[model samples]
Target chain A: MRLLIVEDEADLRVALTMSLEEDGYVIDSAEDGEEGLYKAMNWDYDVIILDIMMPKMDGWDVLAELRKEKNTPVLILTARGAIDDRVKGLDLGSDDFLVKPFDMAELSARLRALIRRAAGKTSTVLTYRGLQLDTAKKTVSVDAIAVQLTALEYALVQFLLMHQDTVVSRTDLYEHLFNEDDDSLSNVLDVHVCNARRKLGGTYIKTRRGLGYTIGD
Target chain B: MNKYRSIRWQLMAWQRFLLAAVLITLLSLHYHLRRKSEIAEVDASLQSALMSVMPAVAPMMGRGGPPPYEPNSNAPPPRYEPDEENNPLIIAETYLEEIESNGYYVTSWDTEKGLMLSVGAVPASASLGNYELIVETPHFLTLNGNRELVVTHNTDLIIVIGRPLTDVNLALKKTRYQLLLVGSLVFLIGHIGGGIIIRRTLQPIREISQTAEEIARGDHSRRIELAAAPEELASLAQTLNNSFNHLDSALEAQIRFSADASHELRTPIAVIMAQTQAALKRDRSTEEYKTILQACLRAGIRMRTMADSLLELTRISGNGSVLNMALTNLSEVISSAVEEATQLSENHPLSFQTLENSRPVQIDPERIHQVLMNLISNAVKHNPDGCTIRISQKETAEWAILEIADEGTGIPVDALPHIFERFYRVDESRSRESGGSGLGLSIVKSIIETHGGTIEAASIPGQGTTFTIQLPLNPASDR
Candidate 1:
């Protein structure tokens, strides 16, 4: 899964990025609302974590501008505990809200729920042709047998499994595979695809020439 | 027990007291004047009669010329029966009748002959005084059970004269009744009409007091609705309303300040909690754990800094501008502030430089140093690591001015005026991200003002910002 955190607090931003990255999410972040808005509009993210108070602009303006052009799911984060502030953030088309000083586990669960709901799947586990990806446990299985896969390989498979029938372009795969801080120009995606094919019996992973990767029977 | 007296009641009581006193004085004066004039008229009638009768009767009794009527000595006989044609009885009878007809009575005596003659009704009991003009004025006496006023003359014979005084008494009684009726009506009218006028004039004050009471009961919205009140009470209502508005705004400010301070604290707390959770997620190398600990420490320090700044700001507000004065070297204070800021800062190197010497100023040194630290720290917090902040000084004859200028992303022009106000953030996100409590400039301003100084901000967007502070060399002693 992929996520974007738009927060201005340097320490909180860095800490959240590290935590979500460890939870098997490719997380990108911006230090202020303007940069956050630009990146959010430019990329296809599974979920965007937005802060209501930010420099240059605020999450409301970002959400309003983004809703005009995109349907990316957004989860709001704020320090304000006032119900009015929370309601205002949600009323501006954010998908969910979490007050600051929240538990990392709770944030992780909410993000997973948002991503699953966005993918049109009602469960944390997605299956295709006897292959299952347990999103919460970060594990995969083939025909009732667990397949030990690297974190990147697991992420690639889960992304393919969630989309299932749609043709995911190289750009979309590359964009979701790594965050803004990673060296996306490298062959990390190709190597991860090679490793996933070698592990998944090499036939279920199919690539269309001049298109991107896909998963089908 | 409390005495619950309305303003109208007190007013009416005072008005009634003053009216009754005035009417009593005027009615008594009128009664005395009427009686005095009536007595004088009767005396004049009696005197004219005595003058005519003394001359004519003396010739008829043959005791000629002003001598026979000496009241204490001998006199002519009344039996001589002055000539019917020449006697004074016949000569003065018609003249005396004229005075007598207007309610006078006449009597005369001959001392040597020991005889008396009189006309008109006599009193059932009356005492006559010896005839002398210098002795007594006329007085009212009872005659035939009727009141009369009599006078005397003694040039040739004892002569006593009188007029009935019954009309004077009846006039006084009628006047008393008329005055009593008119005075009661006037009092009644004044009581009701004046009471209404007073209440109308004071209606604004009554409304204001009622509104104030309602406000005290926690409805801050109520106000006096007096439109056509008198000028003095109108101004009173305005002043009271103004104070209520000020109090309401002060309460609003208090609420906003707390909300803002809590907002500044939450992000750092979130960072600390997230970092701790991440570290304990799984086994990690010593280096990674150290890095997590460092992150936690930085977040904790940020929270502490914000908390401290908020506390300082509130303390200054509570204490107002009361300074603990001390005579101190201004340059040394600036030098120490620069040293402390440079020494304590790890990420950003903030520098302060001064250009001129200063006489020792009367100020609270610790507080002024705190103000200097706040200004420099604010600069360091906002700008990048390499940005240089310059502190310079100049002086007029009476004031010492210090300028803090920064080479960084400057504030916008519109934000300059409110930069020193409490909880006023030019950029809310940046202020919170930089770990500011939004009270730094306000604290600096308050401390400067405590030293009897003024502070202002000047900024150019994308270039730099400058803060100028002017402190008096000598604070006002009278304050």
Candidate 2:
């Protein structure tokens, strides 16, 4: 996928471009708003990563100018985490935004999501070892047979499917699936996995004791 | 009474010293002048008396008449005696003695009573015949007597007069008492006058000092009265009051500004974070995951826009002079804003119109673009899909006016005035759900105000709402 980064800070820009490039993205960079606007107007990009504070022109101007031309998906990067700035950018027709000093995983995920949204693919489905889940329909089908699953069981299956063959710790699963009031236990994740396994009629999920769980074909 | 009591001791001590010195000086001068005048009077009287008797005595001595009264050649020369009751020499002698007791002393030898004998130790040279005069002595005075006695037969009699020294001392003592009394009275008056003046002069200063103390104790409103005070002090008081006013106003503004800034920052951060957290708490199918991801993207976009607007507002607040400003066509700006807003709304029905002969306005294009985007997006966000958003632009001789009207649920009247305030939302819950950070109108107002334009909102409860922006066409356009 092709991406453009509009950032004034050289170090952050280099870091982001390298990271995104490593993630299989063809990265183009603009040092400031003028260049960003020019690049955005002339070239097609899967996503535009913009910073609010830049020289020549600012992120808002570039975003407004881009919106005037095309509906290119833009993800703003700003040091100011204030919501009003976010709202103003969105109100000006930006696709998404990420605050500075963010984890690379979150950025990548957001970038993926923005690309998916721009491509008009609202329903995202994932399949692993005959366990298939349709995200938009909120339904789970196991081996061409629909399986009734609770919210938690379904979330556990989905997490296992996304990180197939990679160990996900209990803390990671709990943080992603449960609210604060949920009494999370290592055994509770085990129970949910057991229930999902029983419903799938297979032993697809594997547990590395004292470490985490993984899904394998 | 209290006022007098305060300085009573001081007054008393000062008066005592002054009175003592004045009394001493007055007594000394009185004694000096009294002694001088008494001596002059005595001399004048003695001279006059001597002149009267000299003629009588001088003829007798010239005729050698005293030989007629020579009692005997011996027998102590008979101690020549005048008629016992009516002798002029005896009368003059008594008068001299009286004047001497009154501080004027006289000494004399009477010719009728003396056989060359002196009554007050009068000097013989001083009593030479027919040569009468006054003299000052340590203990007495002497004058020439009328009778003359001489071996030369031509001189007949000699008269003498004198005064004792004790009488001059007596008169000086009497004058000392009178001077002491007068000086005491003058000093008493001086002390009373000084006390009154000092008290009057210090009263205002004392009041001011007390008022200052009260103010230091946290009575911020304590103020000194300027009436009846000197001009310089009054001006100082006025300056202090002015400074207090400025301090109060600055403090109030700072408090209000901080509160508004914090409130504006809090709501959106809370919403984005809460929504993200909520979305993360679920596991979803492909579509559910996309929906959750989309929601996150929406929130992320919302937060970014808010940050951008906030940065813009802060930058404009710092220095508005750097904005790229130019003469812009209002109709074009409105049309573009509406078109972009329609796209953002996924092609919500939007209508646009322009008055005939519309004039262009001078503005910062980027900021005005922000303003129009914010306003139109706000209108579309609050309205249902396919609701008509009418945008119009017109130009008078003085101003270029642009307006956006929406048939959405209008803002509540109570919230109208506060709509332009940062993060002030009429419907907080609804705004959060609609992905609004509530800074749209604030940014719009900031942009419009930066361009020297005015924006106002008018809304009906159920009918519709309109926001109008008026920008000055030129510097002399009003003229």
Task: Compare the candidates by lDDT and give the number of the best one.
Answer: 1
* Per-residue lDDT of model 1, residues A1-217, tens digit only: 7789999877778788888988888999998889999999998999999987777888889999999999999999988779998888788888999999899999999999998998899999888887888999988888878999987788899899889987888788878878777776656677788889889874778888788889974
Clashes of 2: 51
- Tell me the tens digit of each residue's lDDT in model 2 across B313-410: 66675255866777777777776777677777754578888876676677777677778888777877777554677888877788888888888788
What lDDT does candidate 1 reach at residue B210?
88
Q: What are the candidates' individual DockQ scores?
A: 0.51, 0.02
Q: Chain B TM-score for each model?
A: 0.67, 0.44
In model 1, chain B matches the true chain B with a TM-score of 0.67
Clashes of each: 4, 51
TM-score of each: 0.67, 0.34
Look at candidate 1 and tell me the lDDT of residue B338. Answer: 84
Alpha-carbon error at A120 in model 1, in Å?
5.7
